[model samples]
Target: MPLEFAPANADALPLHVIEQAGLDGWTESQPKSVVTWVRANNFTGSIGQVLLIPGADGAPVAALVGYGKPETRARKRFVLAAAAEKLPEGAWHVASGLPRDVAETEALGWLMTGYAFDRYKSQTPAKAGLVAPEGVDRTRVETLAAAEALIRDLVNTPAQDMGPDALQAAAEALAAEFGASCTAVVGDDLLTHNFPMIHAVGRAAVRAPRLIELRWGEAGPKLTLVGKGVCFDTGGLDIKPASGMLLMKKDMGGAANVLGLARMIMALGLRVQLRVLIPAVENAVAGNAFRPGDILTSRKGLTVEINNTDAEGRLVLADALALADEEAPDMVISMATLTGAARVAVGPDLAPFYTDDEGAAQALAEAAAGAADPVWRMPFHAPYEDLIEPGIADLDNAPGGGMAGSITAALFLRRFVAARYMHFDIFSWQQANAPGRSKGGFGQGPRALLAALPRILNL
Candidate 1:
């Protein structure tokens, strides 16, 4: 079932969040039996500690969750969710002890804890529901979770079911729901439409490649989003080892996240003309697959030497970014699970983005902290621009020597983008399950961008 809020006025019991130092005083207000129960259970209010107090009737009358010390809380996100997961299946509300500034965030964390991707098996989540805390918008918080579920569902699907055609169908479905326009340029038509790089990277796969486009909201500042949609990367002619191919199904995580962001924007009726471009493909190995030495011309007329076929995500994105720049929208952003170097640099938890606009960067940084969606800004670094410039062609798909690889990949995509652009190198997969997050397809940057759009676009 979807994550939802319990009715504002339901038969919900009080849930108290306590700190270690204040535990004694908190218990003083409770009945003697409840205090005895809490003390006997050694409930010191460490972070995520769970303790339920029973009434004279021997039924749970209230619950307690430890908020822990300031330092413990500071080191983690979704602190409330840690304890929320341990609660029994029922409606819950934070009655007291949570700080005001964190009320909304904690409420959201509660909802996130309810997510479970059970599309294939019987992995149903506990039917735990949270009442929206005071001053938090339940509708907005729930909508965001639904949109996030869309990304998780799409990314969690195997490449066999989520090929280019399926991805395009997903986009069309979203466009239909919003009364927007959705279209695609597929297969040989990609060549006809001048998306040669996208075609070249995906032509080897049995499933045709496509540039999926969805447009919405005609009356506001134009913002275009480009996402890399490589459905399954076998690394083409330069195939990856078997171990590297295990998670290849998540290569389209960027497109999944973009569609998720699009859902957020359209659902809220945000005042902005939103255009989404996703270059959908599968970097599968085949007899006629584009080779390592092959040179492909992009829609922008820049030639890229394929030094490594594993670098195909950037190729497809280059064409899409060039197309996005043609309109010179107020802003253009590209999201891609583009490089392993990104994970090596900041690990899988952080979304690393690059942009030249200080205002937009600052706005995003501020919004990320508030949203609990962290993003780190990487520099364009003009001094290293030469790293992408291979002598054989205007650019090299993968520069030799892996030093600063994420930066080089960013610079390569930067060549095709001339608008006020930002690129997010997202992992888009949860490395491990913790708190509100699960161990499967996950989102990294959409929330931060969603929160920052208003300030960045003056919407």
Candidate 2:
């Protein structure tokens, strides 16, 4: 996209951003022909309003995007980006009018607008592009955009090509790029190595199940990330209806998102000894698939009664979280597309997280807002602990009566480890297309997590 931008020269179109209050003064400085054009169009600089000033030859000489009202800008993060998509086909540079504090975020938003998933179908790339905005970190913005592309690409791929083996390859590729170490416990080796629940839940699929681990960095506080890698959930023996299967390809979104953060961390050289654990699997149904009423033992030695096979995501995540907690890392954070209850709680836009650490929670909330990545802190409410405990086994995979589903799921994962743990119940699919974010596998929480890490870990 940077390459697509018209070279920063006299030939490039200058893009001026205007607010309603400055409209008259801005017009006063323009040529009479341009002023008349602006007045005739009644361009008041409201959001999403675009206009082009033409020269005597009639080709566009300049372009402008409205910044809208102060209150309108306050309610949205990437308001200018939405208007960016509507600009005329040509290269442009931000000439003036972006506040210095927002310059970087808006520039990053422009880079985000460059994404297009062209794997299965050829896409006509956007002709319009922007050079790096003034006073912005070019390296940081590109790194973030590239990492985000990784998450979207991995999640966008179909389960046929993105199963456990492929997921392991992706992680190993990332590790190789950073000169880190990566290893996976695959198929029957999982049971031989004590990841019983992970093996059991994924055993029915023809594609083998595996536990992938990547290690990097040597000098700093330990940061461990555990992600649920359910590539495609057919809901095992409990079986979801056809409607429930449409976006199942994004079930592995959590793993993709964690890897996105890892990419940002390594690329930015954050001071942390990072360990990423992914339990990659396919929750498919076969005669031998793990079923309801089956009691399985987790890596942490907790027994879990499966009341619903559809709850297999937390089962795999449980084993991975247990493994992550073993070394007592400074922090353990797990991300997963875990439950529909989470979607009901906050809809599809906000990532809902659970943690008992107040200081860390506060830091993350503040950081998320600044990063333009919204995340809400849900409690690790102790009162809901009993809801996950089944009389028969030590825990219930799916508690009946389904109240506080997200909280109960978080509590169930909490039972596996004792650490400064935070869990994000994410809905990683973007249901509608918007500027900078197309309607497919989208990342949540990771950008916010990236922003908050320095403060949360005291780097």
Candidate 3:
């Protein structure tokens, strides 16, 4: 977004910073030397000890912000953003001493603070975008923020309008824009096309569930992206409480994320054969809905016992993953608003991903760090594999144990993937309101994944 308040960078900046500890009385002749020094340098003063400074023209210059000590965790950069909200609308840089990591995060926080979801509201008051101190690509930073914003809008929309058909339509629209091939196996065609699990999970909905496939890039390394597109999960036959159903619309956030990633990939013209698969469905409760205790056959030819209908996300993902696996693509990645356990484990800010490949994992971590959209690596512990066992089926969609709910969910999806796969169990919602991320639906992992792709396919 274009900044309402534009602040330009110059050759040199007059900085004002608060002195901490013993440095307070460096120039002791005057009581307000800190303020005087700040003014002399064309900067501002701090509050730990407030003092005013006169500039070259004998006028008040820039202001100084103080952090008594270093921010322990990187996330505390938001405190600086809160400070930015108060600073006068001008090109202002943090004239204080902070670590390189703190500086980067604070800059990101400033960008985030400039975010306002004014799709339905009036324009917000102008706020200037921050200027990175020495070395930072402002465009790359904004791309990550914009990707998250796009995913949030898609996930926050109601399922009535964001249903399977609409989801497929959205993918088609994106494919059309990028000159990609868009196709779908809709309704009964899912069975005809061997996507039994996907069809079974979505059969109850009146709008009909579908497997939307989009293929882009004709000559490059084949990369497949699959997402759990449960538009609104009602927990199938197992049924969820009223509270659990409240945020079900965001269940399809995985699809939203992948689609958002695709937009970035195509927009940047990344050199990779991008194939996006979204198994769009609404896990609604009805007479025809798939039931717990039922055995469903996945596209990979594995029979899965439905221990809990509430665990339907992985079931649909099973088929989609199986389809992606068939191509044995160079790389395959998937995202899903798959489990509450993930939320309980990591809260909402950091997304947890599981991958068996070390090289991919390292690349993803580096990209996440560079992009400022970090993801934590959760082990796909082999010992926990037994939790997903089924007595009468090849596997159990819902594991018998709840200890490693997120891990088991990833493991279940793993069963269908025969190639290099990275699975994300994302919370996909912001618990509280903050700058760009509203108090509702938010995209968690797309930006990181998008950033990592260039390395993944060696683009």
Which stretches in model 3 have alpha-carbon errors above 4 Å?
1-68, 73-80, 88-106, 119-126, 131-134
By TM-score, the best candidate is 1
Give the Å error, residue 227, model 2: 1.0
Question: Which consecutive 10 residues in model 1 have the weakest lDDT in total?
Answer: 119-128
* Tens-digit per-residue lDDT, 258-278, candidate 3: 988888788777888899999
Q: Tens digit of lDDT per residue, candidate 2, span 141-187? A: 77888888899999999999999999999999999999889999999
Off by over 4 Å in 2: 1-11
Each candidate's number of clashing pairs is 0, 0, 5
- The local distance difference test score of each candidate is 0.90, 0.88, 0.76
Clashing pairs in 1: none
Q: Compared to the true structure, candidate 3 yields what TM-score?
A: 0.83
Q: Model 3 residue 298 lDDT?
A: 86
